[model samples]
Target chain A: MNTEKILLDHGSGGKISHALFADLILPLFDNPELSCQDDGAILDFEPGRLAFSTDSYVVDPIFFPGGNIGDLAVNGTINDIAMCGAVPKVISAGLILEEGFLLKDLKIILESMASGAKKAGVKIVTGDTKVVPKGKADKIFINTSGIGILPSGIHVSGNNAKPGDQIILSGTLADHGIAVLTAREGLSFESDIQTDSAALNTMTRQIIESGCDVHVFRDPTRGGLGTTLNEIAVQSKVGIKIYEPSLPIKGSVQGVCELLGFDPLYIANEGKLICFTSKQDAQKTLEIIQKNEFGKDAAIIGEVTHTDPGVVLLQTAIGGVRLVDMLTGEQLPRIC
Target chain B: MSLKYVEEFRDGALAKQIIKKILAVSKKPLRLMEVCGTHTTSIFRHGIRSVLPKNITLLSGPGCPVCVTAQKDIDTFIHLCKQDDVIITTFGDLIRVPGSGSTLGKEKAEGADVRVVYSVFDAVHIARENKDKQVIFCAVGFETTTPTIAAGILTAAAEHIRNFCIHPANKLTPPALAALMETDGIHIDGFILPGHVSVITGTHAYKDTFEKYQIPSVIAGFEPVDILNAILMLIEQNEHNTPGLQNAYPRAVSDLGNIKAQKITSQVFEPCDAVWRGIGSIPSSGMALKKEFHPFNATKKFNIQAIDTPEPAGCACGKILMGLKNPTQCALYKKKCTPMTPVGPCMVSSEGACAAFYRYN
Candidate 1:
């Protein structure tokens, strides 16, 4: 129990493996299905339509300010399924550890995953672990697969967007990308920013249950809001226009982006979501989202237009219009 | 936390007021060129072109250091990566720039020890940490970045970091402007000088060029209102037939500039004739390490000979940099060249006019 670090033997399926599951993993994610310690967990469910998703996390510097790769993996997969208008039920995790990774850090990560699953009202039913030699991988990586049940008479898709649909962003942008970049060694900066990684299933589920004409529910992750909106606009064959003044951005995030000469719209956001709905329900949905803990800064930022199909335009604060194109490649810090 | 400077300049009302004044004073068609990559990016990001009067045409100039980097210098960096126990360090902007046959990025992917660093000091640190390997920093930039590199070399010398060296491809702004004016068939009515460079060399740096060329020039900050205000100043100067060097960004720049930093740059480097990518050679426009500090010169230490590398055929980057042609006028823009398979440095560098045009237009 006092082992300071993981070794190759941790994945040998011997006493070390069992202790890793018992002393660290089991105490945090205490559940009967995981307690069985079998190859798979037996599940019972009623016959209904189901949704499934799987994703892997190999984030550098596995630990960040607000959260780490563990909870990010869980919340990412859960939100993926929830954005489909389904209630995420069960999840599985797979861990790949480097030989020299600290077991104490592993415990912290597992506890984070547990808390995230607990808040989302889901269970981590089963998982597998494997350890690689030093230099074979980064410190740690996680993969999560999730399943959710779709309720009757509920459907949401990117293609469901229509002209006159309003776009509602969940909250402030660019916190997670800036946090991760600044935390990296040799790039440290004095700032109070932190990663915004969290589960968005609760609010998304409420919106679906509110009987609103919700067209699309998307979490803008890697490419941020600009690329996400472009995807929806293309899929729906409609034009989109965003008001630059209405974008919910924290002053600190804006300052960092400006200093780095980066566009806040193209930066990543871990916890923010973009909801596309009819104009009539945009205010109601915005008010509903503001009620959730993660959606306090939500606002209706843009709307779908009929002209210039598949193009996203931005109306600048000074009354100029330009195309908000999809992000072509990775955004990097400028030398200036 | 207040970001007072950013908020004040980004004011929508102030931006509108500047545009209104510009619209009122602008009578004749004017050809204005923004002479900084950061300005190019800011203009596009703010949608400045969309709101400008049709009579005023904004053209991107040779302000991007990456775009102006000599083709031969890039090829030399790629060749140095092939040397034994040599690790090439560079800024992110120079990584993907294509030379004659390869880039540092391709060399790294092929197992060369090429590392990206935010500053020259990081390369010095890497050399200090790894005594067995020689760390060569690719020093590519304009006046705004030269002083810091010079300071890093001084730090390396004081600490006796013998394993660190620099491949200097540094350029000057005023000489390039003078070169552009001397070029035949290049017509630029006014120039929006670079703000960051002006902050270092000060407003007096452009006095000689301004007096000789009699060109209307304004050094403005990199904000929406700042740029619009500069445009209005240029229009008024042109309308009244009065040409002068005006510092629209007076908050940071002064007549003398930061004297201590200027002295630091002079102590480590000397002016040399440097070759620009499409513009050929501009005399006394580039900086090289002083003879006393020749040990810090990667080219001298590695015994690498400078070989001229030819630019891509039919590439209009040269004409674009001089504002003689637009990026759309290029035969290969968006056809054979793009941000993804870029054949020219203009297409690759983030602040390149071709890139801004492709992304914004």
Candidate 2:
């Protein structure tokens, strides 16, 4: 605990590594299976199907407004499993640290992961840590893998979106991407925006427990809502028509996007999910989602159309229609 | 946060009214070339082509700095990256532009220290931080970007930042317009001038081109309403046979433009004969650092050599930029080329015509 910085010996599996595991990580993620010092967790559960999802967080800066890479990594996989209509149970954290990383900063990150697990009622059952030379990698990178138990007879997928189905967004879009963007060192812009990185398992559980014949659940993470909708359209072999005015966006994020010439439609999001449901159940599903704390800004942004299979269209707020194509290449900030 | 003027210019009713006006005034088939990459994107993003009358066609021009950057310049960047103790910093737009053997992106993946910077100041800061390494900025842009880069060089010189240098491939808008007008089989009725570049160069920059070509032209903003209104003006001018210049984007652009910025740009750099990707060499079109600031020129400082090379075979980016052919007409488009594996700069740059077509189509 008195170490000023992380050393190569900390990942060497010697006495130093053991002390790091025992003194730092183990107590924060203290659980029966993890404390046993086994290679992996041995779990016992009732007869059911389980969903397993893994994601890596290599976001630049690592720390941004509202959250750091720690919670973002945990919440990312948790949301991934939640999108599969399952209750996330446990997660494993993998940290790859640069040699000169500060132990104090690592503790802050670990504390964030522990609190994130506590909030979601999940346990960090197993983990690994590694250290590389100073120039081998960025300051820190985290990888999280999680397991979830699916409810009986739950069938939700990107392919399930049918014609006439309503598309519901869980909340406002593009917070996580904008937050990281504004927090970047060189390209920093002043904005009161923060990452909307949160556990979506509880909110997703509410919808599945409601049992209203939900067709699809997806987290629009890297490609934003526009690309995600295009994906659903292609997967379901249907066309989607989204209304621009109904979409929710914070004015500050929108302003930043405007200045940078970025379309919020293509920016990344972390704490939101899109649901496609039948017309009759759409109202009920939307209301149930709206009741959740994370789903406060939820709205039906679009609908699946019978025509133009595999295409996504946006009806502009100003009364024009434009095709929302799949985002191509890295969306760089524009000079014009 | 809700931008008032932004929302006003995007007014649906105003766009509809302007479209109606364009429809009523149009008499003959017209090909209007929007000379800015940003305008091309805005036009396609709003389905402007779909709304316009069948007779009127909007063409993407050679305005994208990335798309127009010569292959030799790109090769020079990759070559510099291969040298030891050198770091190449560039705008995101030029990172993907293909050279003869590789791109800056490919070199970076192969262990080169290639960095993507948003502005010239970022590269200067990188040089200041890494005193042991030489930082070469890939300076490629139009008037909107040149002044900023010039300012960065001035700051670096004042601070005596010896490690900081730039490989400037900067271009001028008016010269490129004239080059296009002189090309054979290039018949554009009117020009939709660049809004941002015009903000720096002003409406007066196009006066020479207008006098020579006598083509109806309007400097238009990137909003749907502004574009529609400009289209109506161009339609009226074409119908009346009054081929002249007008500034439709008066709010941001003026008669003289940003004089201080222009002055600084002139102080730091001078016009030199520059080769464009598909457009060949245009006299005094490219900007190079002045002889007094040779120390700030990366090519001179590092003794790097330019590799003269031709465009990729079957890539119709030049013709496409000239407005002689649409994106689909390119032999390699969506066949041997795509955004993922771009065969030309037009497909690589976000502001490129092929990229705009591929995205919105």
Candidate 3:
């Protein structure tokens, strides 16, 4: 098989998928935990609460501004586990490769995945692979399931959000979406804009270690912070009120969104997350998050509310309230 | 904390006052045409249409470059994609724009050598690296994007990059608008001229259209207040029976426009007859690479044939773009031609009328 040319057999479940994984994937991401082939790997550690989470990545232009499918796959899962107020320890990868995908590209992706795992202090413990016909799938789609161990007395969940709980965003909104859109649109500006795709587990770990009693945690990926908050509101049966003025937005991303007729709030993001906690602990959480490199622009943007259950409302910079709902469909650029 | 001139222009108080004046002056069921895609988006984003009186209907026009690109042009670019040693680069918005049956995104997924690029410069850079492949920039947009392509062409010429070429589908705004007025089925009371395009071509260019149609034209910025003020200006003019050109985006656009950008565009391109998606053929509405710059023109370099193809049956994007129908009027709009699975030009182009309605409304 030519490493540069992808074939239909690669996506076939029997021989092609296994050979592709063993030859191209395993060598790049060679870790002891992943070597043991089982239904699921068993970890031996001291008694503590375990955090398990799963995520799927299907971003277009598979490779984008700051990162590609490899790092994105690892970071997404790690972030999910971290959101549970735990330190991510292990991950399992499942790949859905399209037939006729270049093996060289897959190798590059594996190397990125390995590096991302190293950065987030996590190990690839187990994995599975499947390949489909060229037309049956995108070039490559990855799903990652992660497991983490939380420290004693640390608990976090979406339903834990309470009234007057301060809402904090790690950094800017819509960076990942704009970066993806810019790359996808084939529109360029004078400044080079890259995706803010990175593992937020480190930042989350520091905040949890600060003993600020984080009530809830969520990484706003698809549907951005607005949709994520709306989901939390619905799940927790509470209201979320956000101040538009406090939302951190990069000037370039804002300009592109304005020019392309996109709302920053509705756009997708990958690297940022939201934390909801008590007002008293909010200051300490903000300070701890600010100390980290990724959380430099961390801000307390809003608070959870008891009014208007299951709704997310935004107070505009001009002091007007508007309902921020989950984006109904894919946001296409509109000339009007 | 500093509110720039553009920021102040969107003030709600000013917008409310302008809306009041527009309501007071206009007759019942006044139809105003917004001729820029940016204006349409701003109108929807700011919910300007909701705040206005029910009788005052703001109609979307052929201001979107993506919606106006003819099917033949898209087919020609898709044909270029069939070549093994060819890399077809274009803006993200153009990827899903339907040609006849399939889109560029679909073609790319089906193993076509297509890549989305942010700028023409990126295409040039790709050409610089892949000397064996022909890098064709799927050059689409109005005057707002023309200058960048012109600059890229100049750079490619100076750099002597043999692999780079442009499939120039770049159209001028005023000529298409003029064609709409001359054609049947258009009964517009006034015009809301596009702000960004005017910043490039200048507001003076619309003087002829205003004089010819006896309609008031206001080059307005993409803001709530700017659009409202334009409507008020148009209503005021209609009431007084005085038709002329006005500037509501005075901070950015002047009567003359950006002289440097215009000079660059002129140096690289010449006015040519172009096929608009909805409004048939319009003379001098399209820009083509000059004879001296023919080597960099993708159409000439690849001998691309312009084939006549019809839009998908029952798709009202063409009519919608021409201000003859609304998006909800289209049978396929919500059912088949959505943002994810676009089946028409209006659904495909990000700046298209149908796309705007689907996204905002």
Candidate 4:
């Protein structure tokens, strides 16, 4: 119990493995399904469509401002399910730990994961752990798979975006990306910016159940708003037009991005979503989203157009129009 | 947390007024070239091209260090990456730039030790930490980045870090401008000078080129308002037939520029004939490490040889850099070359004209 670092025996499936489960994971997760200590978790579900999602977290620096990989992994899968207009029910975690990783760090990560699941009202039903050599892996890597139930009356898809649909963005952009980049070694900067890695299931639920003509619910995660919009545009065979002045972004995040010669549109966002709804229902959906704590800065950013199908356009702040192409390759930091 | 300068320059109302002025004054078919890659990116990012009159065309010049880097130098970099016990540190902009055979990105994927550093000092730190490994910093930039590389060399020497070195691919901005003016069949009405480079070299650095050519020029910042204002000044100069150089970005650029930075740069590097990627060789356009700093020169210390690499077939990056051709004019532009599968440095470098045009237009 007082082991200072993880060891090979931690994954041996013997006494040490059992102790690690009981002493660390069990008390933290503290759920009946996981307490069974069996090969798999058993659960009951109503007859409905099930939305399942899986994601892996290998973000460098493992820890960053505002959140760490633990909560990021948890919330990532939850948001994926929620984006399908489903209520996240349960999640399974798989951990890959390095042998020399600090036990204290592991406990902190587990604590965050447990608390993140509790906040999202989802249970950590089952998980597996494996220990690798010290140099074989980073400190820790977590993979989470989640399942959610979709109600019968609610249906949403990226292909459902119509010509007269309006696009709504939840909160600000580029907070999570800038936060992680600054926290990285050899690139540290003095700033109070933090990752916006919060569970968006609550906000998604509010908009989904609001009786609006919702078309698409997407989280702009890795490629930011620009890539997500392109995906939706191509899927729906429509064109998108966004207003530059209407896009919400934190001042600190914007400053960092500008300094680094990065486009905020292509930067990553974690706790933000873009919704497509009929023009008449767009205002109602915006108000419903604004009622959530995570959607305070939400706004009607753009609209779907019938012309120029599969292209995304931006109405620049200076009243100019330009194409918004999907992000190509990785967004590298500029030289000057 | 308050980005005061950033907010002030990006004022939509100010940009609108300047744009309106530019629209009103622009009558003739004038082709203005922006000499800096950052300027090109700013113009595109703010949709400056869309706002301008159709008769007024903005041509991208050879200001991007990566886009202008010669094929031989890129080949030399890739060759150095293949050396044993060597760690190549470079700016992120140069990672995907293709040499004749391969790129630094491809070499890294093949298990080469290539690391991206934001500043030259980070490479020096890497060399200090890994004493057993020879860390070569790929120094590719203009006046805006050369002084920092000079400072990094100084830091390495003071600490006696012998393993740290840099491959000097630094270029001078003024010489390239003069070469552009001297080129035959090139018709440009005015020039929007680079703001960041001018911050170091000053408005005085371009005095010789301006006096000789009598071309209207304006140094501009990388903001919508700044670009629009610069465009308006160029239009006025052309219309009035009074060719002169103006400093539109006086907040960062002065007549004399940063004296200490210039001095430090001269202390470590000397002007040499450098071959530009799309353009041919130009005299005194490149900065080579001084004789005293030979030990810090990766090319000499590692005995690297430059290879003869030809430019891509049907690629107009060189013509594009000289403002003779646009990206769409190239046969390999969007069809065979893209940001994901770039056939030229103009498509690889984030600030390259092709990249800015591809992403924004």
Candidate 5:
């Protein structure tokens, strides 16, 4: 507690390591399973299918407008499991810190992660920490792995999309990507853009419990909606047609994209999900999503098609149709 | 947080009305070429081609600075990066553009000091931070970008930043349009001129080409409504047999253009003969740093002469740029040539005709 910066001894698994965990980590992520101090946490679940997911957080700056890397890491794994129509139960955190990384920053990140788990009604059961030399790593990196239980007769996957299924986006696009890019070291732009990083497991639970016929649930993260939709089209052997006018994007985010010559469709999102539901239940499903705190801007953006299988088409605002191809390489800014 | 102009330009009802007007006016089997790469991208991005009449063909032209960058210039950029105590800073697209032997991205992976900077001023900042290293910015853009690069040079010169320099591969748009008109087998009825470049060059810049060739030309913005409005103007001109240069993007572009930016560009650089990637060299189409700014010229500072190299075999990027061929006409397209493994710069740059066609089509 007296240390101003983390050192190699803090991760040695000796006296210093235990003191660091008991004083700093344990107080924030307090729980019965984590307090036992065993090799791993033990848990029991009711009769159901198990959904396990893991993700690593290596975002630059490690902090942004709405959220930092800590909550992002926690919510990312929780959303992954939730996308499979499961209720996320417990998560494990793995931290990699630089020797000279500030202890204060670590405390803030840990506190956010703890709160993120509490809001999602999940437990931080077990965790591990390691420290490398000062120059060996960028400030800090986190890996979170979580498990969830799926209820009976719940089925959702990328390949489950069928003809006539309406596509519902949870919210606006490119908030997280633009927020992080603008906050980077040299590229400075004045805007109030914040990362839409939040736990979506609660929203997913409502949709699953409602018993509306659902086909697919995917969080458009790294590749955004464009790449994720292409993946679904290929996986389902169906075509998709999204209306340009129906896409919910913030005006400021669109402005940034125009200035940098980036397509919002290909930008990343952290707290959004794309759900595919039958036409009969699409309206009810949309209403359910709109009621959630993170789904105020949820909209039915597109629909699955029978023609042009394996291709995703966008019905442009100007009444023309074009292919929304999968992202080729990193979406680099145009020269002119 | 909302942009007023962007929304007004992208209004769905306004775009639909323009499309309807274009449909009614476009009667001839005309082939219109959008000279700017940004126009080509906007046309595809808004699915403008799908709404136009079947008789009208929108051809992509040699406006993309990165796609039209010569192999020799790309080689020079990679060569500069390989030098010790040197850092090659460039726009994002140029990193993946393949040269004769290797690309800047590949070279960077092999331990070369290469960085993708958002602006030329950022490269100047890099030079300031790394005092021992030489920062060479790979400058490839048209009139819309050249003024900014020139401004960066002025900043570096004023601050006495000795290690900062630029590889001036900048090009002028008006000359390229003239060259396209003279090319054999080229058949273009009208032109959807680049909005950004025209903003700097002004509506008067295309006067020579418009008068000499008697072709219909209209400056356009990148939004759907702006492009559709420009297309309608071009169709009306062609139908009435009145070939003239018009400016549809009057909000951003004017007859005189940005006079201050033009002055700054002339202060730092002069017109020079530059080679195009697929097409051969055109006279006075490229820009070179002025003699007074010789110390800020990367080509002279490094004493490196990049010999012109042959383009990749069986690539039809040149023909495509000239509006003589489409991407599918190329034997390598969608087969050996793709966005992931591009054989030509056209496939790598986001504003490239091939990349736009591949993505939207």
Candidate 6:
């Protein structure tokens, strides 16, 4: 793994990725599920319906505040499947590591991934690893794919958003982005700000079982709430309007965003999700989410609108309307 | 919370009207130079140039502290970080600033004693705590930060903190502007003086440049409208052949500036020849610790020799900072030097023109 020269064979889906995995990753996390080699593993469970989902993780600084690529990989895929009112059953991981990656770091990352997967009650069944040269790729990039079983008569997607549905934010926005920025830029304050990276499968399960009619579920990850709502608005062909004052945000996150000229709404999140449910069921959903450890600060942020199809608008705190556009280019830190 | 109605200062409608008035009055192409890096960032961030008339071409000057800091001086600070019992305290932006081989952040990761301090006073506080160790405050910036560093020096001197020292890279803004005006490479039509620095040094500091170069200079605020208004003023001046210093940010800056800040700064430091990153050494452009305050000088305390260090082989940061070339004109801008992995000081500082262009533009 410490060899200077990187070769294309490292990324090849043959013996090189396997050797790199065995020599670097397996010894760190010698787990039963990860040891098994197959296209896909079957989960033995009494299920009403199977909720299958997959995702690829490609974040810079492979390691950041609160969590790293490993935990993010496991939690991200699990949260995606769990949003469908499902319990994550089995998970698969793929690694695209650079040749000069440290063996010790890979061990730590895998251990984190295993711990995260175990906590969610999801086993890593199948996996593949490939390594590119040092300059050809970043230090480490992990891709995770998972499958879960949905409960009976439960279905959730972006298209499920309906008029009069209340939009709820799990916790806060811009925590992950600020944490990453602070860590990367070496900016420190008297207040200790850490990334709120965690698996939300348990919280999602609690919301679903609380007898609330959740119309839609999505995690505001890469493009934040703006992009996520834009996707839902387009998918459902409905208008989404959120209140700026109602959105939950930490003071430190707001301060950093203001100084750095970054928009908190478009900043990234790791352990947060947006749920759309009926006004009648919104109270029940909020109550259930608030009771859970991960969703303690959950709040009803906004609601869906019937006008202006396939668009997201934010009514500012000062009583003005602004279009919440999907983030473009790189989300550079700004002093707003 | 004291709200100052900063929003009203960015009125786009008023700015558009002002722009229209300036364009109607202008006779030829005008080149306005924004001396503050913050102004440069604001100009691009708000797309101010797009709204301005085609006759007005905005040029970025050497207002960025990181961009103007000499490569050799940065290397010297990096060298100080290598010392066993020394702790290098500086702003967060200076940590990632490239020196000879690596940056302070990279060196800190590799076991160098580097700490990011928000204020110069924090460095003094650190020195008091670590009595046995040497605390070297990497003092970098213009008039805005000089007073704070001066105050820290006064505090350290009064406390008799033998361990506290400062690597002074504090440079004056007006002298550098004068140096730029003297250079044949740049042909700036007017000047947009730094707002924050003007709040400390006063508008009077630029009187010499205005008298000599006859360039209309405005001390403009950071807001979008402040920049737009300053551009309008420049265009008007160019049309009427009126070249003098103007103040667009009267709320913070005055003709004389903060007297207390200037008194402390003058009492603690003296003018000296300073080398700029993109620009050559300018006499009386930088500040040094006063002889009575020699105990607080890091260069004297450590007896560190000033080693001549060259820029990266093909880096055009010098030309970029002088407004002779844009960041994209540099061959290594996006390819070899990036925000994540920068090879020059301009790309490192958040307030730097290159960083602004790379991130916002």
TM-scores of all predicted structures: 0.98, 0.96, 0.75, 0.99, 0.98, 0.66
- Each candidate's number of clashing pairs is 0, 0, 17, 1, 0, 7
Give each candidate's interface RMSD in Å: 1.4, 2.0, 5.2, 1.0, 1.1, 7.8
| Docking class of predicted structure 3 | incorrect
lDDT tens string, model 3, B6-84? 4576566676677677767777567898988777766765667766778788899988878888888888888888777
Off by over 4 Å in 4: A1-3
DockQ of each candidate relative to the true complex = 0.63, 0.53, 0.16, 0.80, 0.83, 0.06
Native contacts retained per candidate? 0.41, 0.46, 0.11, 0.77, 0.89, 0.00
Candidate 1 lDDT for residue A173: 93
Worst 10 residues of 5 chain A by lDDT: A1-10
Q: Which 10 consecutive positions of candidate 6 chain A have the poorest summed lDDT?
A: A327-336
| Predictions in order: chain A TM-score | 0.97, 0.98, 0.92, 0.98, 0.98, 0.88
Give stretches of model 2 more than 4 Å off.
Answer: A1-3, A36-39, B1-4
Worst ten in a row by lDDT for model 3 chain B: B1-10
Compose the digit string of candidate 5's lDDT tens values, residues A1-336. Answer: 336999999889999899999999999999999999999998978876999999999999898888899989999999999999989999999999999888999999999999999999999999999999989989999999999999888889999999999999999999999999999877989899999999999999999889899999999998889999999999999999999999999989998898889999999999999999999999999999999999999999999999999999999887899999988778888787
Q: lDDT tens digits, residues B240-278, model 4?
A: 998899999999999999999999999999999999998
Q: How high is the DockQ of candidate 5? A: 0.83
The residue pairs found clashing in candidate 2 are none
Number of clashing pairs, model 1? 0
Could you tell me the lDDT of residue B248 within candidate 1?
94
- Pairs in steric clash, model 1: none
Q: What is the lDDT of residue A331 in candidate 3?
A: 64
lDDT of 2 by residue, A130-169 (tens): 9999989898999999999999999999999999999999
Of candidates 6 and 4, the better by DockQ: 4
CAPRI docking class of candidate 6: incorrect
